[model samples]
Target: MSSYYGRPVLKEPVWKVPDVPAYLYLGGMAGASSSMALLAGLTGRQRLARTGRLAAAVGATASVGALVHDLGRPMRFLNMLRVVKLTSPLSVGSWILAPFSGLAGAAAASDVTGLLPVPGRAAGVVAGVLAPAMTTYTAVLLADTAVPGWHEAYRELPFVFAGSAVASAGAVGMVSAPAESAPARRMAVSGSVLELAASRRMEGRLGLAAEAYRTGRAGMVLRAARAATAVGAGLALLAGRSRAAGIAAGACLTLGSIATRYGVFEAGRETARDPRYVVDPQRERLRERESAGRGEVH
Candidate 1:
């Protein structure tokens, strides 16, 4: 078909902006709640522990809902369970998420009324272990897509998502738990440190994959990500034992992480549609082919 631009115009996601807001809410909740669950298990705070566990369960449950709701056919989401495929990240993720959700729910449910006896503690342990991936998988989910910026930022994206998750969890601690949440502050601090370290590594570590951090909308997003992750992480540590400071740090991380995710999504779409992503790479391939042809003839 003929076109004014001779190509597809850039567009936003197919889903309604309102119908499916980004996974920010759920991702953050899951990340933050895990830390709380850990704190509960470690510190022996029954009520907050239960609360965190419940939060994680609720967040994971809702996130899955959002993901399916946003799909072209929400009912078809279950089709992923029929078979296992290692080659497909989505398949792997579906499997990973399945048990994680169950464990998180079990832990949360167990915590609610304190009825698990031995099984509840075991469930909490399981949830705590998987918490990291629960937060990090969203990055993998995005990277697995054909989306350019997301795939490009694969290495760093995980770290970015991780940082955001940690920060978010800290926020939950600050808000729902208690002023005496010493461990909550510590978890927030730990999360901040990990996020900062990972993000810094992201910028210098990956090669061409790192380009997502350097140009256009991606650049702006990465810059903001660095600032937020840095400040939030730094401040969270400094905020040690202060619920207010901890919460603020959590909020900072939350905002920064959200911006980072949105920016990433936007950048991915930008990269996908732009000819450079497809054309330039192929141009290099063609040149290499021509050079090889001449070499064979000579």
Candidate 2:
């Protein structure tokens, strides 16, 4: 409730809009697309598999470009690779991004050009194996930060991100291979459910921190995301091979995923700008601890 001159106790995030948000969205889409590609290939849906590979390749490449652009230098990103630290989310994320970009690109190239079929499938498989971590590591990266909204929602953030990733990939599949996209539709529906549910749970449990997510610009964007995702899922369920419906659903789902990422990023920024979000929580924790100690002594 109190602060030095009413200034924020924590530094606001320096990440720029569109760059960091785009990186998060594209990386998540690529990771889930790779997994979808691997599964589709194994099931003999070659067209769907190829579509997934292409989507994953493009998304990964764009994601890395956005990240590098945000960093202001390619070398900064490279520096993250100098040492692998399990305790560092940024380090782990860089490693994941680097290999994922290569593998996804190679897989897509081979599938498109019909060259090195064996190697292409192998690369796709490896990328698929790393996809889950790729999709959710960003959540860890955000949650590990000092930002109140993100850190407080750590318990459900990964699930929210994973669901968004899956839905994004599934949307790609729906748009690209509508006729053979039963699996994609299923993923879209299930992922939307998970994303919506986890988001609700996360906000509900955040207590004071939830204000950042429920007010201002962050609130509007997040509300839009929820609406789009819900509508997209409904459309996916009834698409039934209609190319128009599939495309519409895919577009909505993609928009929803993008909105979610930006909304979360902005929420963290909002929390960091308000000293109340920081000071109030710490004070409450101290009070609880003090009360517990007194009771134990008595």
Candidate 3:
């Protein structure tokens, strides 16, 4: 409720639209697709594995491009690799992205060219090992910032991100592989459930900060994401052997995943542009601490 000349109390994130959100969505998809590729390979679903690998490669390459573009210089990204700082999410994320891109590319090339079978499989395995971390690290990176909406939702953001990643990967699988790829449909349904549940829980728990996610551009995008995901999940369940239904479901899920990333990004920006979203929760925390102190004294 307070402001300096009616201006925001915190500096808004300088991250640009499309670039940052695209990076988030693509990185998540790449990571989860790598994991799916690993699973498909182990299960002897070679076609699905190949599709997953290719998707991962493409997503990773584009994600890195988006990141470099956002930074305004490719060397700026390289500079982040100068030293490893475990305490910094940006540093950790940089390390994760670099290796993930290389591994995903190697795996995809091997799958497509039918060469370097041994090394390619190894790269896929390693990429799969790093996939979970890659999918969720962006959430940590966002929550580490001062933005009220993102910071307040830290506990659920990783789950939300991971679910979105898996759903996106599943959508890719469904679109590229045959309708017989039951694993893809299963992943879509499960991932959508997780994403929606986590999002709802995050909003309910955020109290005042949740307003950022429900009252503007962020709200509209997220509402659309939820609708798409839910409908896609239902369609996937009823798709059976219908290729058309599967494709439709996949398209919806993919859009949902994209919207989720953009919506969250916008919510953080919204919170940063408002003083109340920053001050209210902080004041609440201080009051809570004071109340606890008095209780202890009594």
Q: Residue 201's C-alpha lDDT in candidate 2?
A: 98
Give the count of colliding residue pairs in each prediction: 2, 0, 0
Candidate 3: residue 101 lDDT (0-100): 96
| Whole-model lDDT, model 3 | 0.93
Q: By summed lDDT, which 10 consecutive residues of candidate 1 come out lowest? A: 12-21
**Of 2 and 3, the candidate ranking higher by TM-score:** 2
- Please, what are the lDDT tens digits per residue for candidate 1 over residues 85-140? 98987787777677777888877777666786578778778877877777877788
User: lDDT of model 2 at residue 206?
Assistant: 99
Estimate the TM-score of every prediction: 0.79, 0.99, 0.98
Candidates ranked, most accurate by TM-score first: 2, 3, 1
Which candidate has the highest TM-score of all?
2
Q: Pick the candidate with the highest lDDT.
A: 2
Residues 1-298, candidate 3: write the lDDT tens digits: 7787999999999998889999999999999999999999999999999988999999999999999999999999999999999999999999999999999999999889989999999999999999999899999999999899999899999999999999999889888987346898898999999999999999999999898899899999999999999999988886666888888999999999999999999999999998999888889999999999999999
Note each model's CA RMSD in angstroms: 4.0, 0.8, 1.0
How do the candidates rank by lDDT, highest first?
A: 2, 3, 1
- In model 3, the worst 10-residue window by lDDT is 173-182
For residue 89, model 1's alpha carbon misses the true position, in angstroms, by 1.1
